[model samples]
Target: MKQAESVSDFYKRLPSHAPTAVPLDNAGIGHINVFSRETCSVVSPYSRRDFYKVSLIIGTGRIYYADKWIEIDRPALLFSNPFVPYSWEAESAEQSGWYCLFTEEFVQHSERMHNLRDSPLFRIGSNPIFFPDQVQLGELSAIFQKMQAEMASSYPHKYDVLRSYLHLIIHEAMRSNPAEHFAAYSNASSRVSALFLELLERQFPIDSPQVNLKLKTPTDYAGALSVHVNHLNRSVKEITGKTTSAHIAARIVSEAKALLQHTDWNISDIAYSLGFEYASYFTLFFKKHSGISPTQLRGVV
Candidate 1:
Protein backbone atom coordinates (compact mmCIF):
# COMPACT_ATOMS: atom_id res chain seq x y z
CA MET A 1 0.00 0.00 0.00
CA LYS A 2 1.11 3.52 -0.68
CA GLN A 3 2.04 5.64 2.31
CA ALA A 4 -0.74 8.12 2.95
CA GLU A 5 0.01 11.68 1.96
CA SER A 6 1.11 13.82 4.86
CA VAL A 7 0.22 17.53 5.17
CA SER A 8 3.61 18.52 3.88
CA ASP A 9 3.30 16.01 1.07
CA PHE A 10 -0.13 17.39 0.23
CA TYR A 11 1.36 20.79 -0.48
CA LYS A 12 4.33 19.33 -2.25
CA ARG A 13 2.27 17.06 -4.46
CA LEU A 14 -0.23 19.71 -5.47
CA PRO A 15 2.16 22.00 -7.25
CA SER A 16 -0.42 24.63 -8.00
CA HIS A 17 -1.54 24.84 -4.38
CA ALA A 18 -0.36 27.84 -2.44
CA PRO A 19 -0.53 28.38 1.30
CA THR A 20 -3.31 30.78 2.19
CA ALA A 21 -1.46 31.89 5.31
CA VAL A 22 1.53 34.23 5.02
CA PRO A 23 3.83 32.36 7.39
CA LEU A 24 2.66 29.07 5.86
CA ASP A 25 1.97 27.31 9.14
CA ASN A 26 1.92 23.52 8.73
CA ALA A 27 3.28 22.98 12.24
CA GLY A 28 2.24 22.95 15.94
CA ILE A 29 -0.84 21.46 17.60
CA GLY A 30 -3.86 20.62 15.50
CA HIS A 31 -2.12 22.39 12.61
CA ILE A 32 -5.28 23.37 10.82
CA ASN A 33 -5.10 25.58 7.77
CA VAL A 34 -7.51 26.64 5.05
CA PHE A 35 -6.90 27.39 1.36
CA SER A 36 -8.73 28.28 -1.79
CA ARG A 37 -8.81 26.04 -4.84
CA GLU A 38 -8.44 28.97 -7.19
CA THR A 39 -5.88 27.29 -9.42
CA CYS A 40 -6.40 23.63 -8.65
CA SER A 41 -4.25 20.67 -9.61
CA VAL A 42 -5.18 17.04 -9.70
CA VAL A 43 -3.97 14.89 -6.78
CA SER A 44 -4.39 11.56 -8.57
CA PRO A 45 -2.75 9.31 -6.02
CA TYR A 46 -6.12 7.87 -4.85
CA SER A 47 -4.72 6.77 -1.52
CA ARG A 48 -5.24 7.40 2.19
CA ARG A 49 -4.68 10.76 3.83
CA ASP A 50 -2.60 11.11 6.98
CA PHE A 51 -4.97 13.69 8.45
CA TYR A 52 -8.61 14.69 8.12
CA LYS A 53 -9.91 17.04 5.38
CA VAL A 54 -13.14 18.87 4.56
CA SER A 55 -13.33 20.30 1.06
CA LEU A 56 -15.88 22.66 -0.46
CA ILE A 57 -15.53 22.11 -4.17
CA ILE A 58 -17.19 24.62 -6.47
CA GLY A 59 -15.76 23.24 -9.65
CA THR A 60 -16.28 20.13 -11.75
CA GLY A 61 -14.16 17.15 -10.72
CA ARG A 62 -14.14 13.44 -10.07
CA ILE A 63 -13.65 12.23 -6.53
CA TYR A 64 -12.05 8.89 -5.80
CA TYR A 65 -13.66 7.49 -2.69
CA ALA A 66 -12.79 4.16 -1.22
CA ASP A 67 -13.60 1.55 -3.88
CA LYS A 68 -15.90 4.04 -5.61
CA TRP A 69 -16.10 7.34 -7.43
CA ILE A 70 -18.13 10.56 -7.28
CA GLU A 71 -18.25 13.13 -10.06
CA ILE A 72 -18.87 16.60 -8.74
CA ASP A 73 -20.26 19.07 -11.26
CA ARG A 74 -21.95 21.14 -8.60
CA PRO A 75 -20.95 22.71 -5.33
CA ALA A 76 -20.21 19.80 -3.03
CA LEU A 77 -18.97 19.22 0.49
CA LEU A 78 -16.54 16.34 0.96
CA PHE A 79 -15.72 15.03 4.40
CA SER A 80 -12.49 13.04 4.25
CA ASN A 81 -11.45 11.09 7.29
CA PRO A 82 -8.04 9.53 7.75
CA PHE A 83 -9.07 5.92 7.42
CA VAL A 84 -10.67 5.98 3.96
CA PRO A 85 -8.61 6.47 0.83
CA TYR A 86 -9.64 9.33 -1.51
CA SER A 87 -8.53 11.74 -4.21
CA TRP A 88 -9.91 14.39 -6.62
CA GLU A 89 -9.34 15.62 -10.16
CA ALA A 90 -10.28 18.95 -11.69
CA GLU A 91 -12.18 18.30 -14.89
CA SER A 92 -12.54 21.97 -15.71
CA ALA A 93 -9.67 24.33 -16.24
CA GLU A 94 -11.12 26.70 -13.67
CA GLN A 95 -11.73 25.54 -10.12
CA SER A 96 -12.89 27.39 -7.06
CA GLY A 97 -13.59 26.63 -3.40
CA TRP A 98 -12.01 26.11 0.01
CA TYR A 99 -10.61 23.26 2.08
CA CYS A 100 -9.16 22.72 5.53
CA LEU A 101 -6.61 20.18 6.75
CA PHE A 102 -6.23 19.19 10.37
CA THR A 103 -4.33 16.55 12.26
CA GLU A 104 -5.88 13.96 14.62
CA GLU A 105 -4.69 15.81 17.72
CA PHE A 106 -6.66 18.77 16.51
CA VAL A 107 -9.71 17.00 17.85
CA GLN A 108 -8.27 14.02 19.70
CA HIS A 109 -8.79 15.42 23.22
CA SER A 110 -12.35 16.57 22.70
CA GLU A 111 -15.80 15.00 22.54
CA ARG A 112 -16.26 16.61 19.14
CA MET A 113 -13.84 14.03 17.82
CA HIS A 114 -16.39 11.28 18.39
CA ASN A 115 -19.15 13.39 16.91
CA LEU A 116 -17.10 14.12 13.81
CA ARG A 117 -15.93 10.57 13.41
CA ASP A 118 -19.31 8.99 14.11
CA SER A 119 -21.23 11.37 11.86
CA PRO A 120 -22.43 10.00 8.52
CA LEU A 121 -20.28 12.49 6.67
CA PHE A 122 -17.00 11.03 7.95
CA ARG A 123 -17.93 7.53 8.91
CA ILE A 124 -16.45 4.71 6.85
CA GLY A 125 -18.79 3.17 4.23
CA SER A 126 -20.99 6.30 4.33
CA ASN A 127 -21.53 8.95 1.70
CA PRO A 128 -18.70 11.44 2.08
CA ILE A 129 -19.86 13.80 -0.65
CA PHE A 130 -22.84 16.13 -0.21
CA PHE A 131 -24.16 18.66 -2.70
CA PRO A 132 -25.58 21.70 -0.96
CA ASP A 133 -27.78 24.24 -2.75
CA GLN A 134 -26.86 27.89 -3.21
CA VAL A 135 -28.00 28.88 0.27
CA GLN A 136 -26.15 26.13 2.01
CA LEU A 137 -23.10 26.83 -0.12
CA GLY A 138 -23.15 30.44 1.04
CA GLU A 139 -23.28 29.35 4.65
CA LEU A 140 -20.43 26.92 4.13
CA SER A 141 -18.41 29.41 2.15
CA ALA A 142 -18.69 32.03 4.88
CA ILE A 143 -17.24 29.65 7.42
CA PHE A 144 -14.31 28.93 5.17
CA GLN A 145 -13.89 32.61 4.41
CA LYS A 146 -13.84 33.24 8.15
CA MET A 147 -11.19 30.57 8.44
CA GLN A 148 -9.01 32.44 6.00
CA ALA A 149 -9.57 35.60 7.99
CA GLU A 150 -8.68 34.03 11.29
CA MET A 151 -5.69 32.29 9.83
CA ALA A 152 -4.44 35.70 8.75
CA SER A 153 -5.38 37.31 12.08
CA SER A 154 -3.11 38.55 14.86
CA TYR A 155 -5.49 37.36 17.58
CA PRO A 156 -3.89 35.41 20.41
CA HIS A 157 -6.61 32.75 20.49
CA LYS A 158 -6.97 32.55 16.71
CA TYR A 159 -6.55 28.76 16.82
CA ASP A 160 -9.41 28.45 19.29
CA VAL A 161 -11.51 30.51 16.92
CA LEU A 162 -10.42 28.33 14.01
CA ARG A 163 -11.45 25.23 15.96
CA SER A 164 -14.94 26.67 16.30
CA TYR A 165 -15.01 27.41 12.61
CA LEU A 166 -13.99 23.83 11.92
CA HIS A 167 -16.83 22.61 14.10
CA LEU A 168 -19.26 24.88 12.31
CA ILE A 169 -18.15 23.57 8.94
CA ILE A 170 -18.43 19.98 10.15
CA HIS A 171 -21.88 20.67 11.58
CA GLU A 172 -23.03 22.07 8.25
CA ALA A 173 -21.74 19.01 6.39
CA MET A 174 -24.34 16.95 8.27
CA ARG A 175 -26.82 19.81 8.11
CA SER A 176 -25.39 17.85 10.20
CA ASN A 177 -22.61 15.67 9.53
CA PRO A 178 -17.76 15.03 10.23
CA ALA A 179 -3.44 10.71 16.37
CA GLU A 180 -1.29 10.13 18.33
CA HIS A 181 0.69 8.90 18.93
CA PHE A 182 1.56 14.49 18.18
CA ALA A 183 1.51 17.92 16.91
CA ALA A 184 5.08 18.26 15.68
CA TYR A 185 5.21 14.67 14.59
CA SER A 186 1.81 14.86 12.81
CA ASN A 187 0.11 11.64 13.93
CA ALA A 188 3.28 9.71 14.60
CA SER A 189 1.38 6.74 16.01
CA SER A 190 -0.88 6.29 13.00
CA ARG A 191 1.99 6.73 10.57
CA VAL A 192 3.99 4.20 12.54
CA SER A 193 1.08 1.78 12.62
CA ALA A 194 0.52 2.14 8.88
CA LEU A 195 4.16 1.59 8.12
CA PHE A 196 4.26 -1.41 10.43
CA LEU A 197 1.19 -2.95 8.80
CA GLU A 198 2.68 -2.35 5.37
CA LEU A 199 5.86 -4.09 6.42
CA LEU A 200 3.99 -7.01 7.99
CA GLU A 201 1.61 -7.54 5.06
CA ARG A 202 4.41 -7.21 2.52
CA GLN A 203 5.89 -10.48 3.75
CA PHE A 204 2.63 -12.37 3.38
CA PRO A 205 1.16 -15.42 1.49
CA ILE A 206 4.40 -17.41 1.72
CA ASP A 207 5.06 -18.25 -1.96
CA SER A 208 7.59 -21.00 -1.31
CA PRO A 209 8.77 -23.30 1.46
CA GLN A 210 12.35 -22.18 0.83
CA VAL A 211 11.49 -18.56 1.64
CA ASN A 212 11.40 -17.61 5.34
CA LEU A 213 9.28 -14.96 6.99
CA LYS A 214 11.52 -11.93 7.37
CA LEU A 215 9.45 -9.98 9.89
CA LYS A 216 7.83 -12.29 12.42
CA THR A 217 7.85 -10.33 15.65
CA PRO A 218 6.71 -7.07 17.17
CA THR A 219 10.30 -6.01 17.74
CA ASP A 220 11.06 -6.60 14.05
CA TYR A 221 8.13 -4.45 13.00
CA ALA A 222 9.04 -1.77 15.52
CA GLY A 223 12.62 -1.65 14.30
CA ALA A 224 11.49 -1.47 10.69
CA LEU A 225 9.11 1.39 11.46
CA SER A 226 11.84 3.04 13.57
CA VAL A 227 9.69 3.12 16.68
CA HIS A 228 10.17 1.60 20.10
CA VAL A 229 8.50 -1.76 20.69
CA ASN A 230 6.34 -0.30 23.44
CA HIS A 231 5.30 2.57 21.18
CA LEU A 232 4.45 0.15 18.40
CA ASN A 233 2.39 -1.98 20.77
CA ARG A 234 0.47 1.01 22.09
CA SER A 235 -0.07 2.57 18.66
CA VAL A 236 -1.15 -0.67 16.96
CA LYS A 237 -3.53 -1.46 19.80
CA GLU A 238 -4.89 2.04 19.87
CA ILE A 239 -5.57 2.14 16.12
CA THR A 240 -6.33 -1.53 15.35
CA GLY A 241 -7.60 -2.68 18.79
CA LYS A 242 -5.02 -5.47 18.72
CA THR A 243 -1.55 -5.74 20.11
CA THR A 244 1.47 -6.09 17.81
CA SER A 245 2.15 -9.64 18.93
CA ALA A 246 -1.45 -10.61 18.40
CA HIS A 247 -1.41 -9.22 14.87
CA ILE A 248 1.80 -11.04 13.98
CA ALA A 249 0.56 -14.30 15.48
CA ALA A 250 -2.79 -14.00 13.72
CA ARG A 251 -1.07 -13.52 10.38
CA ILE A 252 1.19 -16.46 11.01
CA VAL A 253 -1.72 -18.68 11.99
CA SER A 254 -3.64 -17.61 8.93
CA GLU A 255 -0.71 -18.42 6.65
CA ALA A 256 -0.20 -21.75 8.37
CA LYS A 257 -3.80 -22.71 7.70
CA ALA A 258 -3.48 -21.77 4.05
CA LEU A 259 -0.31 -23.78 3.72
CA LEU A 260 -1.82 -26.77 5.44
CA GLN A 261 -4.88 -26.78 3.18
CA HIS A 262 -3.64 -25.50 -0.18
CA THR A 263 -0.21 -27.12 -0.49
CA ASP A 264 1.36 -30.48 0.24
CA TRP A 265 4.40 -28.88 1.90
CA ASN A 266 5.62 -30.75 4.93
CA ILE A 267 4.53 -29.40 8.32
CA SER A 268 8.14 -28.80 9.26
CA ASP A 269 8.77 -26.78 6.12
CA ILE A 270 5.61 -24.77 6.73
CA ALA A 271 6.75 -24.07 10.27
CA TYR A 272 10.22 -23.00 9.13
CA SER A 273 8.82 -20.86 6.32
CA LEU A 274 6.61 -19.03 8.82
CA GLY A 275 9.57 -18.22 11.06
CA PHE A 276 8.93 -20.96 13.61
CA GLU A 277 12.07 -22.99 14.25
CA TYR A 278 10.12 -26.05 15.44
CA ALA A 279 7.05 -27.70 13.96
CA SER A 280 5.76 -28.31 17.45
CA TYR A 281 5.80 -24.57 18.15
CA PHE A 282 3.80 -23.88 15.01
CA THR A 283 1.25 -26.56 15.94
CA LEU A 284 0.84 -25.12 19.43
CA PHE A 285 0.31 -21.61 18.01
CA PHE A 286 -2.09 -22.81 15.32
CA LYS A 287 -4.15 -24.70 17.89
CA LYS A 288 -4.21 -21.73 20.19
CA HIS A 289 -5.73 -19.39 17.62
CA SER A 290 -7.58 -21.76 15.27
CA GLY A 291 -8.69 -24.27 17.95
CA ILE A 292 -7.15 -27.19 16.02
CA SER A 293 -3.74 -28.63 15.36
CA PRO A 294 -2.26 -28.07 11.89
CA THR A 295 -2.38 -31.77 11.11
CA GLN A 296 -6.05 -32.10 12.06
CA LEU A 297 -6.92 -28.97 10.05
CA ARG A 298 -4.97 -30.06 6.95
CA GLY A 299 -7.63 -32.12 5.22
CA VAL A 300 -10.60 -30.97 7.25
CA VAL A 301 -10.25 -27.34 6.19
Candidate 2:
Protein backbone atom coordinates (compact mmCIF):
# COMPACT_ATOMS: atom_id res chain seq x y z
CA MET A 1 0.00 0.00 0.00
CA LYS A 2 1.17 3.56 -0.68
CA GLN A 3 1.81 5.98 2.18
CA ALA A 4 -0.93 8.44 3.07
CA GLU A 5 -0.50 12.22 3.36
CA SER A 6 -1.93 14.41 6.15
CA VAL A 7 -4.94 16.78 6.31
CA SER A 8 -2.78 19.91 6.14
CA ASP A 9 -1.52 18.67 2.79
CA PHE A 10 -4.93 19.23 1.20
CA TYR A 11 -5.33 22.77 2.54
CA LYS A 12 -2.10 23.72 0.79
CA ARG A 13 -3.58 22.44 -2.48
CA LEU A 14 -6.83 24.45 -2.36
CA PRO A 15 -7.19 25.23 -6.07
CA SER A 16 -5.65 28.56 -7.08
CA HIS A 17 -8.58 29.41 -9.33
CA ALA A 18 -11.81 29.56 -7.41
CA PRO A 19 -13.32 26.05 -7.86
CA THR A 20 -15.18 26.08 -11.22
CA ALA A 21 -17.64 28.97 -11.48
CA VAL A 22 -19.78 27.37 -14.14
CA PRO A 23 -23.52 27.55 -13.62
CA LEU A 24 -25.52 24.45 -12.69
CA ASP A 25 -25.60 21.97 -15.55
CA ASN A 26 -29.10 20.71 -14.84
CA ALA A 27 -27.79 20.34 -11.26
CA GLY A 28 -26.39 23.00 -8.96
CA ILE A 29 -23.50 22.72 -6.54
CA GLY A 30 -25.24 19.66 -5.10
CA HIS A 31 -25.23 17.99 -8.50
CA ILE A 32 -25.46 14.21 -8.32
CA ASN A 33 -23.80 12.46 -11.23
CA VAL A 34 -24.33 8.76 -11.69
CA PHE A 35 -20.78 7.42 -11.98
CA SER A 36 -19.60 4.35 -13.84
CA ARG A 37 -17.51 1.66 -12.09
CA GLU A 38 -14.52 2.67 -14.19
CA THR A 39 -14.80 6.25 -12.90
CA CYS A 40 -15.40 5.33 -9.25
CA SER A 41 -12.53 2.85 -9.12
CA VAL A 42 -10.08 5.61 -10.06
CA VAL A 43 -10.32 7.13 -6.59
CA SER A 44 -7.26 5.67 -4.91
CA PRO A 45 -6.39 5.59 -1.19
CA TYR A 46 -2.97 7.09 -1.78
CA SER A 47 -4.27 10.22 -3.53
CA ARG A 48 -5.33 13.18 -1.37
CA ARG A 49 -7.58 16.15 -2.23
CA ASP A 50 -10.70 17.88 -0.95
CA PHE A 51 -14.05 16.89 -2.42
CA TYR A 52 -17.48 16.69 -0.80
CA LYS A 53 -18.73 13.25 -1.91
CA VAL A 54 -21.92 11.36 -1.12
CA SER A 55 -22.57 7.92 -2.57
CA LEU A 56 -25.97 6.18 -2.66
CA ILE A 57 -25.07 2.52 -2.79
CA ILE A 58 -27.02 0.18 -5.07
CA GLY A 59 -25.04 -2.91 -4.12
CA THR A 60 -22.78 -4.11 -1.32
CA GLY A 61 -19.20 -2.84 -1.19
CA ARG A 62 -16.40 -2.27 1.32
CA ILE A 63 -15.00 1.22 1.97
CA TYR A 64 -11.56 1.76 3.45
CA TYR A 65 -10.83 4.83 5.59
CA ALA A 66 -8.94 5.80 8.76
CA ASP A 67 -7.45 2.30 8.89
CA LYS A 68 -10.84 0.55 8.98
CA TRP A 69 -13.04 -1.16 6.42
CA ILE A 70 -16.74 -0.24 6.51
CA GLU A 71 -19.16 -2.49 4.64
CA ILE A 72 -21.62 -0.51 2.51
CA ASP A 73 -24.85 -2.17 1.35
CA ARG A 74 -27.99 -1.16 -0.49
CA PRO A 75 -29.85 1.89 0.84
CA ALA A 76 -26.61 3.03 2.44
CA LEU A 77 -25.86 6.73 2.89
CA LEU A 78 -22.13 7.34 3.04
CA PHE A 79 -20.62 10.81 3.42
CA SER A 80 -16.91 11.49 3.14
CA ASN A 81 -15.31 14.76 4.20
CA PRO A 82 -12.93 16.49 1.84
CA PHE A 83 -9.30 15.39 2.30
CA VAL A 84 -10.12 12.01 3.84
CA PRO A 85 -8.61 9.32 1.59
CA TYR A 86 -11.11 6.52 0.92
CA SER A 87 -11.16 3.54 -1.47
CA TRP A 88 -13.85 1.02 -2.33
CA GLU A 89 -13.54 -2.75 -2.76
CA ALA A 90 -16.61 -4.44 -4.20
CA GLU A 91 -17.16 -8.13 -4.90
CA SER A 92 -18.93 -7.51 -8.20
CA ALA A 93 -17.69 -5.28 -11.00
CA GLU A 94 -21.22 -4.29 -12.05
CA GLN A 95 -22.07 -1.99 -9.12
CA SER A 96 -24.06 1.18 -9.85
CA GLY A 97 -24.82 4.39 -7.89
CA TRP A 98 -25.58 8.14 -7.85
CA TYR A 99 -22.55 10.13 -6.69
CA CYS A 100 -22.77 13.77 -5.57
CA LEU A 101 -19.88 16.24 -5.47
CA PHE A 102 -20.20 19.49 -3.56
CA THR A 103 -18.25 22.15 -1.72
CA GLU A 104 -18.37 23.05 1.99
CA GLU A 105 -19.37 26.66 1.26
CA PHE A 106 -22.62 25.54 -0.42
CA VAL A 107 -24.05 24.00 2.76
CA GLN A 108 -22.32 26.07 5.46
CA HIS A 109 -23.99 29.39 4.66
CA SER A 110 -27.21 28.74 6.64
CA GLU A 111 -28.09 28.70 10.33
CA ARG A 112 -29.60 25.20 10.25
CA MET A 113 -26.41 23.93 8.66
CA HIS A 114 -24.56 24.39 11.95
CA ASN A 115 -25.82 20.95 12.85
CA LEU A 116 -23.14 19.65 10.47
CA ARG A 117 -20.59 20.50 13.15
CA ASP A 118 -22.62 19.64 16.29
CA SER A 119 -23.20 16.20 14.85
CA PRO A 120 -19.80 14.50 14.74
CA LEU A 121 -21.18 12.00 12.24
CA PHE A 122 -20.52 14.34 9.29
CA ARG A 123 -17.18 15.62 10.43
CA ILE A 124 -13.91 14.33 8.98
CA GLY A 125 -12.24 13.17 12.21
CA SER A 126 -15.20 11.19 13.51
CA ASN A 127 -16.27 8.43 11.14
CA PRO A 128 -20.05 8.66 10.66
CA ILE A 129 -21.36 5.64 8.68
CA PHE A 130 -25.09 4.97 8.47
CA PHE A 131 -27.15 2.01 7.25
CA PRO A 132 -30.61 3.45 6.57
CA ASP A 133 -33.88 1.58 6.91
CA GLN A 134 -36.13 1.01 3.91
CA VAL A 135 -38.44 3.88 4.81
CA GLN A 136 -35.58 6.26 5.41
CA LEU A 137 -34.02 5.16 2.14
CA GLY A 138 -37.14 6.15 0.23
CA GLU A 139 -37.23 9.50 1.98
CA LEU A 140 -33.61 10.26 1.06
CA SER A 141 -34.16 9.16 -2.54
CA ALA A 142 -37.05 11.62 -2.84
CA ILE A 143 -34.85 14.43 -1.60
CA PHE A 144 -32.20 13.57 -4.19
CA GLN A 145 -34.80 13.55 -6.94
CA LYS A 146 -36.22 16.89 -5.80
CA MET A 147 -32.75 18.40 -5.99
CA GLN A 148 -32.34 17.11 -9.51
CA ALA A 149 -35.59 18.70 -10.65
CA GLU A 150 -34.90 22.11 -9.08
CA MET A 151 -31.37 22.17 -10.48
CA ALA A 152 -32.70 21.46 -13.95
CA SER A 153 -35.23 24.25 -13.66
CA SER A 154 -34.38 27.71 -15.07
CA TYR A 155 -35.78 29.57 -12.08
CA PRO A 156 -34.03 32.88 -11.33
CA HIS A 157 -33.31 31.68 -7.78
CA LYS A 158 -32.22 28.18 -8.72
CA TYR A 159 -29.07 28.36 -6.63
CA ASP A 160 -31.17 29.05 -3.58
CA VAL A 161 -33.38 26.11 -4.50
CA LEU A 162 -30.37 23.87 -4.79
CA ARG A 163 -28.90 25.09 -1.51
CA SER A 164 -32.13 24.60 0.42
CA TYR A 165 -32.64 21.13 -1.04
CA LEU A 166 -29.19 20.07 0.03
CA HIS A 167 -29.65 21.51 3.49
CA LEU A 168 -32.92 19.61 3.92
CA ILE A 169 -31.23 16.29 3.31
CA ILE A 170 -28.36 17.19 5.65
CA HIS A 171 -30.74 18.23 8.40
CA GLU A 172 -32.77 15.09 7.94
CA ALA A 173 -29.65 12.96 8.22
CA MET A 174 -28.61 14.81 11.39
CA ARG A 175 -32.04 14.31 12.93
CA SER A 176 -32.07 10.62 11.98
CA ASN A 177 -28.84 10.10 13.91
CA PRO A 178 -28.82 12.46 16.86
CA ALA A 179 -25.49 13.63 18.11
CA GLU A 180 -24.24 11.63 21.06
CA HIS A 181 -24.16 13.62 24.29
CA PHE A 182 -21.15 13.39 26.53
CA ALA A 183 -21.50 12.60 30.21
CA ALA A 184 -22.16 15.54 32.47
CA TYR A 185 -18.92 17.18 33.47
CA SER A 186 -17.87 20.02 35.71
CA ASN A 187 -17.17 23.38 34.06
CA ALA A 188 -13.41 22.94 34.41
CA SER A 189 -13.18 19.70 32.43
CA SER A 190 -15.37 21.01 29.63
CA ARG A 191 -13.47 24.27 29.44
CA VAL A 192 -10.13 22.46 29.32
CA SER A 193 -11.08 20.21 26.41
CA ALA A 194 -12.54 23.07 24.41
CA LEU A 195 -9.45 25.16 24.96
CA PHE A 196 -7.16 22.30 24.00
CA LEU A 197 -8.92 21.71 20.70
CA GLU A 198 -8.64 25.43 19.87
CA LEU A 199 -4.97 25.55 20.76
CA LEU A 200 -4.24 22.46 18.72
CA GLU A 201 -5.83 23.90 15.60
CA ARG A 202 -3.87 27.14 15.96
CA GLN A 203 -0.50 25.37 15.78
CA PHE A 204 -0.97 24.75 12.07
CA PRO A 205 0.39 26.90 9.15
CA ILE A 206 3.44 27.04 11.34
CA ASP A 207 6.24 29.51 10.38
CA SER A 208 8.96 27.21 9.07
CA PRO A 209 8.83 25.82 5.55
CA GLN A 210 11.54 23.17 6.05
CA VAL A 211 10.19 21.44 9.18
CA ASN A 212 7.35 21.77 11.69
CA LEU A 213 8.40 23.53 14.82
CA LYS A 214 6.98 22.44 18.14
CA LEU A 215 4.68 25.26 19.04
CA LYS A 216 2.88 25.41 22.43
CA THR A 217 4.04 22.33 24.33
CA PRO A 218 1.72 20.66 26.88
CA THR A 219 2.89 23.16 29.46
CA ASP A 220 2.37 25.95 26.92
CA TYR A 221 -1.25 24.99 26.34
CA ALA A 222 -1.79 24.53 30.07
CA GLY A 223 -0.40 27.95 30.72
CA ALA A 224 -2.74 29.48 28.17
CA LEU A 225 -5.68 27.60 29.69
CA SER A 226 -4.68 28.99 33.07
CA VAL A 227 -4.45 25.58 34.75
CA HIS A 228 -1.64 23.52 36.17
CA VAL A 229 -0.12 21.12 33.63
CA ASN A 230 -1.09 18.14 35.76
CA HIS A 231 -4.68 19.33 36.08
CA LEU A 232 -4.89 19.96 32.31
CA ASN A 233 -3.49 16.51 31.60
CA ARG A 234 -5.99 14.91 33.99
CA SER A 235 -8.91 16.77 32.49
CA VAL A 236 -7.94 15.83 28.91
CA LYS A 237 -7.31 12.20 29.87
CA GLU A 238 -10.64 11.95 31.71
CA ILE A 239 -12.63 13.57 28.94
CA THR A 240 -10.88 12.44 25.72
CA GLY A 241 -9.06 9.22 26.71
CA LYS A 242 -5.83 10.80 25.48
CA THR A 243 -3.17 13.15 26.76
CA THR A 244 -2.96 16.79 25.66
CA SER A 245 0.32 16.24 23.85
CA ALA A 246 -0.98 13.22 22.00
CA HIS A 247 -3.99 15.15 20.68
CA ILE A 248 -1.78 18.00 19.54
CA ALA A 249 0.60 15.62 17.80
CA ALA A 250 -2.25 13.87 15.97
CA ARG A 251 -3.63 17.13 14.56
CA ILE A 252 -0.18 18.23 13.52
CA VAL A 253 0.42 14.90 11.81
CA SER A 254 -2.93 15.09 10.02
CA GLU A 255 -2.10 18.60 8.77
CA ALA A 256 1.27 17.39 7.54
CA LYS A 257 -0.36 14.66 5.47
CA ALA A 258 -2.75 17.20 3.97
CA LEU A 259 0.08 19.44 2.74
CA LEU A 260 2.17 16.57 1.40
CA GLN A 261 -0.54 15.09 -0.85
CA HIS A 262 -2.28 18.24 -2.05
CA THR A 263 0.52 20.68 -2.75
CA ASP A 264 3.26 20.70 -5.40
CA TRP A 265 5.86 21.76 -2.86
CA ASN A 266 8.98 19.69 -2.31
CA ILE A 267 9.64 18.00 1.05
CA SER A 268 11.73 20.91 2.25
CA ASP A 269 9.05 23.42 1.29
CA ILE A 270 6.36 21.37 3.02
CA ALA A 271 8.55 20.85 6.06
CA TYR A 272 9.17 24.58 6.35
CA SER A 273 5.52 25.39 5.77
CA LEU A 274 4.57 23.38 8.86
CA GLY A 275 7.06 25.35 11.05
CA PHE A 276 10.04 23.02 11.06
CA GLU A 277 13.53 24.52 11.03
CA TYR A 278 15.21 21.39 9.73
CA ALA A 279 13.48 18.98 7.33
CA SER A 280 15.05 16.02 9.13
CA TYR A 281 13.23 16.75 12.39
CA PHE A 282 9.87 16.86 10.65
CA THR A 283 10.67 13.67 8.76
CA LEU A 284 11.62 11.95 11.99
CA PHE A 285 8.43 13.05 13.72
CA PHE A 286 6.22 11.99 10.79
CA LYS A 287 7.93 8.61 10.38
CA LYS A 288 7.56 7.87 14.08
CA HIS A 289 3.79 8.20 13.83
CA SER A 290 3.17 7.17 10.19
CA GLY A 291 5.94 4.54 9.79
CA ILE A 292 7.20 6.04 6.52
CA SER A 293 9.68 8.70 5.50
CA PRO A 294 8.67 11.96 3.81
CA THR A 295 10.46 11.21 0.51
CA GLN A 296 8.72 7.82 0.18
CA LEU A 297 5.28 9.48 0.34
CA ARG A 298 5.79 12.08 -2.45
CA GLY A 299 4.43 9.94 -5.27
CA VAL A 300 1.99 8.00 -3.09
CA VAL A 301 -0.89 8.51 -5.53
Q: Residue 9 in candidate 1 has what lDDT?
A: 85
- Model 1: how large is the Cα RMSD against the reference? 12.4
Report residue 253 deviation for candidate 1 (angstroms).
Answer: 22
Per-candidate Cα RMSD to the true structure, in Å, reads: 12.4, 6.7
Across 18-75, the per-residue lDDT of candidate 2 in tens digits comes to 1243332324333222222333553344342344656666666787764356876565
Model 1 spans with C-alpha error above 4 angstroms: 15-28, 176-301
Best by lDDT: 1
* lDDT, candidate 1, 190-278, per-residue tens: 77776677577567556668888998789888888778899999998988898999888877886676567656789999999999899
Q: Candidate 1: give the clashing pairs.
A: 116-178, 174-177
User: Per-prediction TM-score, please?
Assistant: 0.56, 0.63
